[model samples]
Target: MNNMKNMKVPSGGAASTLAKLGIIGGIGLYAAANSLYNVEGGHRAIVFNRLVGVKDKVYPEGTHFVIPWFERPVIYDVRARPHLVESTSGSRDLQMVKNWTSSPYSSFAWPATYSLSDPWREL
Candidate 1:
């Protein structure tokens, strides 16, 4: 018991310093991860800034970077989709007519005057 009393106790200063450093490192890693975005093939992306509205430029396939929390990337699929349309109606001669159509359609050709505020609504 006498020998135990002679031992010195360690201080908490070193542990507190290490904890502060760990917190800072974790925040830095999180910011870095959130700053990058990827656009896959047949897809596109657009930037929306918090301060301003949507950016005018569209990003193609690949990786791009933006400010974390201040800007966001909105990805869109521009690939063509197949659609089938069928209809049945009476002809000018009072005869029954059946129409069947299959075509490839895509929204990528949307007019330039389209609004950027809510792009998803247009789709």
Candidate 2:
């Protein structure tokens, strides 16, 4: 009891250790959130860099990791997308052009997923 009473406890050690652990935990969480990206179902992801534009590779639906503060991911829906194309007729005749757009992934071939609307001459 006398030795215990005479002993001097070290102050601020536990508090400092807890503070360091809290800071490390916060940094880890931030890094994990920034480094991980989720590509949802029926969707695809493209990796984009801050220094460069869009990356060439397309990631499928899954969880992917990227370098924090260096690269980011852009998600696009690969499902059948709807787009309306408007064309003006040269003559005074009012004609309706019914164009059926196919899906990107289909029997009809396409070079890439991204493309411009082809001029439909057959009205």
Candidate 3:
């Protein structure tokens, strides 16, 4: 993933030197190199391709745990949401007060897989 573009220098001599030197700016350059020595020039930007390693996420506090890499991919989110509510009920002989809720929002962690095919089940 190398992208090299021809950059125009202010002078013909400078442009020729840069091309003769074969200077590539990292992994991102494009176009035919040394094609033009435009004194009145344009702008050029370089882009690079790279591989980034995944970060290891932390589990909940106060609990000892072991996470196997084979069992999980490292992209689960572990945020928490809360809900609270109040309610009431009554009968002929007695009365009761109740507090209840079903939270509309939730967050939890679940393991993901690198390979998703079922082998034994295929047969």
TM-score (C-alpha, index-matched) for candidate 1: 0.65
Which pairs clash in the backbone of model 3? 3-28, 3-29, 3-30, 4-29, 4-30, 5-30
User: Best by TM-score, which number?
Assistant: 1
Off by over 4 Å in 2: 1-12, 82-111, 114-123
Q: What are the per-residue Cα lDDT tens digits for candidate 3 across 1-123? A: 233356544676877878756656421232233222221112111111123223233322232222322122222232333555567777677978575875635332222322222221242
Order the candidates by TM-score, highest first.
1, 2, 3
User: What is the C-alpha lDDT profile of model 2 across 1-123, one tens digit per residue?
Assistant: 899989999888889999999999999999988999898987777776777656667788889999898887777765654444455444457665555554545433323444211111121
RMSD of each: 7.0, 10.2, 18.7
TM-score of each: 0.65, 0.54, 0.21
lDDT of 3: 0.34
Tens digits of lDDT, candidate 1, 7-38: 99977798888999999999999999999999
Locate the minimum summed-lDDT window of 10 residues in model 3: 40-49
Give Cα-based local distance difference scores for all models. Answer: 0.79, 0.69, 0.34
